[model samples]
Target: MASENVKLEPLGPNKTGPNRIQDDGIDDYDPHLHREVESPTTNAETLIHLLKGCLGTGILALPEAFKYSGMANGIVSTFLIGLLCTYCLHVLVRAQYVICKKLKVALLTYPESMKIACEIGPTCLRRFAPYAPAITNFFLIFYQLGICCVYIVFVGKNIKAVADEYTTNDISLTLYILMFFVPFVAIICIKNLKLLAPFSILANLITLVTFGVVGYYVCQNLPPFSSLPSFGTLFNYPLYFGTTLFSLQAVGVVIALENNMATPKQFRGAFGVLNIGMTLVTIIYVGMAMMGYWKYGDKIESSITLNFPPGDVLAKVIRIMYSIAIYISYGLQGYVPVQIIWSNYMAKSLDNSSRKSLYEYMLRIGCVVLTFLLAITVPLLGLFISLVGAFCLSALGIAFPAIIELCAYWPDRLGPGRWILWKDIGLIIVGIVGLCAGSYSCIYEIVRSLASGQT
Candidate 1:
């Protein structure tokens, strides 16, 4: 009976323990008694927030990715990747809900889910359980910081490109990074996401407008279909994998978005926010990649934004608007890691006092500064984005979630004649291959380009 309890226990947050689950999957303890902050996000707001997170600089680089995969492969592969990502997110969210029901908690963040999964996994897998939170945090921190770095590079490079075209002042990328640093820090300091919701909406509107302007340009003088290959060479598929993966990877923030929803149940319904948002995002990605590739062919720059005519007013406006949109979007991405560190690592170590509050402020500012410095040093935006995509997205988006599903459904599915095990194993293998191949290719290209004295 005791052994049975051990195998059939309800997973605890950040630990393995046999929590007593009621018939309704609720614990006897009341969570509201201890709850502090009220999460204030409606279904519509959650959908909008998710859309904002999904649309980022990766979409701007898709034409170059299409340059590698060609238009036909680009469309099919992108939709497939989006579907896979959504499936992984669904697995992760379902696991969270199961654990939440058992633990009698209203929410479980991404890392907490990792810890819980490890806790409930097989006895053989339990030995390394203590490292789960750290492992998850490490990936989450690096990925979020990588995004901030990408934003810094995106803002700095585009702003410098536009400014250099119009004026004789050839400003350094570092200067633009510095100029944006203060505002970046200011935005990140807004602890409550509700406060930043309005900015997210505005940023998304700007992104939509920029997309329209880009489409207009793409339609002006479309290149012949024969000029661009219908299918690219096999060697370039890894690059396509990395860029498409990067463009759609928002796994880091899915739990955060769902947890904050006023009606979290609606997040995963038939026409839920997740499905709706991903479908729309996939459509937009396909449209942009197809149009951008058809227009520019192999001449597409790392960022399609760079391909815009320098003197055109609408082009200039789009560039500026994109910079600002990405700048605002940076805070939303950074918020997850900051919250993780503060809640998991720092807050517990410090007491409830004015100095602790001050420390939080300093920590947020320091993170922004670190990312800015890193971006300024290695500002190869496209390659860096691909590297992060291949590494982080592979782990967070594919590998971990598949493992979580395995752990969540262990004994029943672990026995003979279970297809779940095989499916997860396959996903894990695919994810590992993608991570290794994509990362290696991206790094090799970056090194070769640098050696040949190219950006």
Candidate 2:
């Protein structure tokens, strides 16, 4: 759908409207808060920003996800899941425009859209309208924090792998965690999006090169066809789903990215940045999953990066490259919660304080420490990634978007025989099923791993 064509009828006095929106047409969320800095992201910059945001440590784990679904199922499943995710993103963007048009507002954050959608939907959903924004923020906070923890584990595991080869004195993961903790804190403290953009660009370049190098190694010394399974056990599908979902979906930051665009109107077009970026991301992920599995088969480690030979200097360089890239990414992912918490609750109280800068820096540093401690405690990279994906992202990625679409169009545009209505319902069902199955599988694996002393 074209972004320009997403117009809706203006609402009457009965429906909730943004009567108190800022004169400049931006909503500062709370009356006490000052207007947010105007966004300057061009389409190209937004594209790069999103590409960096979506692809990360999770992409490296695709080979392991392939291990669950096998070659035959993995290819089809990855494509289907990727398509579903893209469509859900479309639904969310469209819903944002629809809600904006009806409410007579210029912009809406993801949580604000959620609240509006719920309030406008059928009477049954209206009761829960007040809680929608909070629920969305809760998921966004934990999801972003979970990603930070994954980055910590990713960096620690790779560094430990390299350190084990050269040094006889085995270094504990905790020490490695401490080693990177300070730098991570330093990175997240850079709060301005423009300042962080350069780092994200560098991170994306490193990831692209890392993908190319990874592909080169996989191309050489490929596994025999006989060694690869065409179809995997049914029980492993959920685990596969969780990892793929984690790797592909970036629902938590959808509105943040769009609202920050130089022209937010371009964000929902047929050839929009979201579609183009997600399309490229899917192709790269599918290629990595299929090729990595072809090279390593069932023998693939939890991360394909770990499968590289220890003594190869190039391999070590790639590991270090990826560690730096993922470390940079920690700041980008953490920025979501940082904005939510700091702006809404902390910023007002601290902004007027004489020690404002000190407290703000401390808050950022403390958040980094929180994620580090969790990463050090759990340390199971693959299992932890899947757990967060299933439990948190499933809702953000699938169920919530579908719900948003339904709520945005219900009883009027989607009354009867409307394909959009049925389509949304189907998507909701798919999302709910994935959420249940993936959650069960990930939790079970975590429990089993704990019992076996794997974590």
Candidate 3:
């Protein structure tokens, strides 16, 4: 908690909204005012917190995604999409930083971040600014729930194997996963976002473990991956496309953290960290996907662990760890959007004449309920990725920041900097084009899968 005397600085009318505090320069921000919110840990703690939360349940499904996209193409696409995602997150970071600095109020909450930004310029722009976070949060809750459910399912399957009991096998795996929500709900009940930081750090470490586990098997199975050079896309391409997108989804998670960072000035260092982390992820994706598919060829399941001999203790152990890791990651991921909605609902309830205190509680219960429902209905893994990525993330992750940046800092502000403006507008335009076109292809593929009666 910050000191009550600590105040947010304000900006000119061009920056702050009509309702905002007038700038007097009297209330300078103590940039370190919120340091108590974090432990003595430095920006590395923040960076890892951002990266690990982003990587969540996606790790379990990434190899499967690669199989959907194809081999060479998927490997290539992983790096390409990661870079593009890094760019999108960078835009959001810039937008949030620029807006927050202008407003002088720290983005202590999600809505506070956006509201402060929109105050920088026009009214209509302000109105639209909140959409991205809202939509992102809506999808994230389900995404997180799905991951946790997967973890629960993994537990049941393993426990059933060991116990040699519970003979009733008629229940759906998804339903069994729902049963764990009683416990998961208890976990989500905790209110502090920063409190999850240590867990997120563990998630990143688990990610490293998963990477190493996969890498070890990959290296030992080197003969199969020798086919990389001969790999051509036309046929093997769709085999691994999905993982490319999965590899980069964490970058969107970065945007959620970027808004909450204590020091906006440290953004450059954060972006550098982000790029390096994504590069590592890309390499791991390429290594795992190329090796797994090349090894098994047509017999490969979406997940390599599945394709491994079932009774092998090593493989089972890896699968268990992998599943647990995804499960924890998703649980953390769910918190990102829930916190945003919870914050906004709390902020608005200040004058909405409603059950203000209860809204926060409602947010927790709603997350558990929604996630449980999703796990049951949309049991298919492919469908989950499509729904989360194309419908939710495409606009929120790809299109929204570009729109905000163009609207917030364009046309006049460049001051004869048409060259720079055109360059950015071109990049933004490219991202928008990619969003529409790529999302169409992904949705088309998902629709085709549904039509074909495939999961």
> What are the lDDT figures for the candidates, one per model?
0.79, 0.80, 0.54
lDDT of 2 by residue, 142-186 (tens): 988999999999999999888889899978887887899879988
Per-residue lDDT of 1-455 in model 1, one digit per residue for the tens? 00001132333542335333332433554332322336567778788778877878888988889988888888899999999999888877876666555555655666666676777766766665678868877887888898899888898888887888877876777787788888999989988988887887888899889888888899987877877787887877888898889899788657767766666677888899999989998999998899898998888888898888888888878888989988888888788678777877888778757699899998899899889888876778878888888988898899888877777666564547777778888888989999999989888887887678665
User: Candidate 1: TM-score?
Assistant: 0.88
Worst 10 residues of 3 by lDDT: 1-10
Each candidate structure's TM-score, on Cα atoms with residue i matched to residue i, is 0.88, 0.88, 0.74
Off by over 4 Å in 1: 1-42, 102-104, 192-195, 352-354, 413-416
List of clashing residue pairs for candidate 2: none
Worst 10 residues of 1 by lDDT: 1-10
Candidate 1: residue 392 Cα off by (Å) = 0.7
Cα error, candidate 1, residue 44 (Å): 3.5
